[model samples]
Target: MSDAGPKGRTGRRDEAAFAITPPQIVGPFYPIRERPDLATNLARPMGSAAEAQGQLIYVRGRVLTPSGKPVPHALIEIWQANAAGKYRHPSDMNPAPVDPNFKGFARLTADASGCYSFRTIKPGRYPTAEGEIRPPHIHLTVEGRFDRLVTQLYFAGEAENLADRWLNAAPHPDRLIVNLQEPPSHLEKHAMVADFDIILASG
Candidate 1:
């Protein structure tokens, strides 16, 4: 089959004609406790003044089918450790202090244009039970009407990416790594932004 050229063109093919996002194992720390109404901001709860401690960042992206069509109202859930490399779970014995302000879990839905955005601090690297170091990444579960993708988002140019077993396992690992940059003038100032578009097999 021929390629669909670039993403914004009008002559794109059907969803089954393109490659979909790769899948990843949902590591050990899926949140257990009841999730707060986190909405999009993991840095601070709505109406609260306290913020999670670390370098604040904005994560924004779209959920689309392989054909480049939007998957509106798709459910997106994310979880990660705090900036101290500690998870707010009962099983994580990492010894790092958990930030009370940061729950590290959020659930949101993509808009009509398949767009979603959230604010949070960058997670820290943590150790595995086998003594291997896991790089900083955000775990995500995106459920579309017909498909669900489980994956991890990695940072670009992180030294640990070279040694991470989970990351290297992906056939196209470069697709999962994103560069953090300065946000636009309309968004918040001083925080970095990472734009990651998720293409599902079908929606």
Candidate 2:
């Protein structure tokens, strides 16, 4: 494939053609290699609000329209559970130690041209079924688009991924988008890398 020649020209832009490169392994214990019927929330992945604490993943991505135009000042909210399989939110009844260092949130004011970034930690897996732990992931809430979106981000290289029965519900090989970068690996206190994006239609 050729490289994209210019901003507006109809040329080969590998970056535009591709998205955050799909990671090697995702999903903790669900048949992630296959596609599952995840048409409903019950069959989909979930992230808590407790995952984004002291650490930072250096999350930097653009909220673009279908035409690839950045949407300035898009409000992006990320929430997820901690590495130990527990939520910092008081409502969560899971019996695990929640990391206090991680507040699990970072608000970015999109730049003049509509780009945003944040420094947050990677989320870990939680119980999806009896004695079962789902693969690590993050939940994102984007509010700048016409309609809000609630999505999940999964790791590309976790052993327990794809074994989670719930993930098997939506077993598309393409669902795995989370990947790890060497620059700043997972923190020793909390381990995992989760990156997710919210795509919108061209306005």
Candidate 3:
């Protein structure tokens, strides 16, 4: 397969087809603390009255094969830092305070249509111990019956994206970046939405 994605003058791929979502490093933080909370809503825990702190957003997308077939029932796991750019893990020593109310992690399964949606807060950018500033992004692991993909999803217009080596180094970087859009009518009016489709090589 070509490392360079097929695109027209607009630099956008045709929606009718999909390229495999490029894989990325699992990173230093992979949620080793305990079992993940399997809720689709990360903004608020099951029993918490308070929502997480940050700009609330909804992420909805589909899991598909490279040939554009839906990969139903695929498992998707996501994790990110809180609004203050601090992770809840003990390994994160960024000096930023962790939000007690932020769940910051979630697990989801694609429906029969290969669609999945989750509610969460926008993460903040954090500085690495190596002096590099990491952009605000969500780490995801998508597992199908026959394939597993680990990657990161980035937001559009993030200045740090231009300098983030992990993002720029992807075989198909643009595929990993998504623009924030108006949330669907069913969701809260104040919330934004980002659509990120995952294309696995096999399922």
Q: Write the per-residue lDDT of candidate 3 for residues 1-203, one digit (tens) a residue.
A: 54345565543454447789999898887888867888899889787779889999999999998767899999999999999998888789999888878868878899988999998999999999899999999999999989999999999999999999999999879999999998779889999999999999886
- Tens digits of lDDT, candidate 2, 26-98: 2232222233221111111234333334333545566665456666767665556665666556555678785
lDDT of each: 0.88, 0.50, 0.89
From the highest TM-score down, the ranking of the candidates is: 3, 1, 2
- Name the better of 2 and 3 by TM-score: 3
For residue 189, give model 2's deviation from the true position in Å: 16
lDDT of 1 at 142: 95
Q: Candidates' TM-scores?
A: 0.90, 0.60, 0.90
lDDT winner among the candidates?
3
Query: For candidate 3, what is the TM-score?
Result: 0.90
Clashing pairs in 3: none
Q: What order do you get sorting by lDDT, best first?
A: 3, 1, 2
Instruction: Give me the displacement of residue 203 in model 1, in angstroms.
Output: 1.4
